[model samples]
Target: KTEKTYELQLLNSEIIIDGKLNDLGWVDVEELSDFMSINYGLKQIPSKKTKVKIACDNKNIYVGVKLFDDSKKITFKSGSYDDFIDTFDLNSDYFIIEIDSDHDHQTSYAFAVNSSNVKSDYLVYDDDLIDDNWNAEWISEVFVDSSGWSIEYEIPIDIFRYSKGGSLTWGLNLIRYIKRHNEYMAWVVLPEEKVGIVSQYGHLKNVNFQQKKTFNIKPYFAYDNEEYEDQYYPYLLDENNGDISGLDFSGGQDTYSLSQSNNKIGFDINYHPNSFSVLDLTYKPDFGQINQDASEVNNTAYETYYEEKRSFFIENSLFFTNSSHNNILFL
Candidate 1:
């Protein structure tokens, strides 16, 4: 296939982001279609049809998608927030969009959604290496009907890093997976040797990225009051021999009620001086509030491993991508 490019235009008005394509701002926009399968080196037309449209404003990028299939037979699945499903799995329908905001082929941000409207976002490095632990705040809506399914996304521009000024162009790629047929289709289909990567992607032109200072602050206060019963130790002398008794021979046991209180206050700050740099600060950040890890029973002698959930360490952990498969690394 040849190189493809889509000219994105500025939105005329605010989009409702309701997963419907009936909005007037979506009218007359270019529709990207004609997806080709890159499965097993065979380039053929997929059984289903898929169409995508994109628009942007000063603060957010808007995307609308329409995929045609039998709604009754569609398989839907959901995962934890910010967690992605297996693309090759036969139990779920998947859609993904990757964008190289800085036009750096080595890095890109991927946003994905399934038929159940479960959204996930991550960072891709060196074309194939992915950091799934990365997280971002974005919005998506999904609607399924008898004909097929449609999706809408509102991705904040501040969530990504990009070039500073002038007319901008970004690398773009789209992927669709059909669960029933186990088919994979892509807008920019590549050769068999170079499949499923971002080294060679299409272009998004006419992008006017707005760069401004953005700050997000979250403050929390926790008050913990713990009350418990405590047992009191008594000094009992032997009745016959004035010696210390080894055990408490007293018939009555003394008990007392104790209470403890703790007050904690903290705040987290995420400051974006511009689209290219970020500063994260925490005043007594609370790591205990993160979701607990899933329970697993290990029957063998080996230790059970757990995934990291702290944002302080998982944010830019992709820099050491060459070290190991794990995202967070300690030097």
Candidate 2:
């Protein structure tokens, strides 16, 4: 298989994570342009133009993409949160980037973002199986203008599991989905059968990265109030006809009380033990922001299974999954 390679330039200055790509670091790096459509016949020229630039520094890898669409028919879904993992692919114009940090071909990380700046990520293994629940702490932004849209990504080195090195070669592929036209394009031409074939990904060379040991602590506090009501049947007696001789159970008494307000305090600690491993610790974790499962009705005898939505359990969940089988074994 032929592989295309690009030598990443070392960033000389800091790069702001804004969607605009006007930084000196990005201007100095070489860009990979003229994306090809997946269909071989359409490879001559793509309807939309895409240009990608890559740069790396000691702590992070930077990716800038400029997509030009003459029609400017952009589709974006509005939401309260920035990260919309479940519906970003179906409802908006987006891009997906597959990265094999170790270049093992057995496993890869997929990151996606839409024109609305909503993000979705996952870990792919065994060729096609995807763990959409996976979440990573990365910076991404999108900006749309009259001509088209542009996106910038700043991926931290700690988010990936790779051997500590100075210069390394990795596997990478870029894919764009135009929702309005239902068009798919890629940086590397791929057959329809090999659409998501990570093994066929091109090569990214001369990635000079320095893994830095870092620690982060996030503390949170929450309060809630709850009210409770109690109801019980009351014993009844007739005074005129000798009380206690007959019992009437026709009425019930109700009692209401307000319990003490609930107060919670917790923190999450992240420690980078090495370049290839990370340790996370949490207390009283809150998963309120996690997306709820889709409503389903099952009348069959077998029970239905739902994906894990909690951020604490979804991040780096492959370690807890049994790769030989499809079950996730949490010990």
Candidate achieving the largest lDDT? 1
On a 0 to 100 scale, what is the lDDT of residue 262 in model 2? 84
Error of 2 at 327 (Å): 11
Which stretches of candidate 2 lie above 4 Å from their native place?
A: 40-44, 79-87, 192-196, 218-225, 229-268, 282-306, 325-331
lDDT of 2 at 124: 79
TM-score list, all predictions: 0.87, 0.78
lDDT of 1 by residue, 1-331 (tens): 5789999988887788888778998886788896887678788898899999999888899999998999998888876666554532465897889999988877889898889888878888877788887887899999988889999999988878888987888999999988878888998876667745677889999888867998888787878999999776666789999898765746666888989999998877888888888877767767664677878899999999765655654656574344645665343
Displacement of residue 131 (Cα, Å) in model 2 is 1.1
User: How would you encode candidate 2's per-residue C-alpha lDDT over 1-331 as one tens digit per residue?
Assistant: 4568877788888888788888887878899985776554356466788999988887788899988875357887765333544456557788888888887876788888888887777887765577766878888998778878899999877778777787888888898988776677887766655645667778889866676787888787778888776765544667787566544455546455668788888777888877777877777777544566668999999999976765556766775564675664334
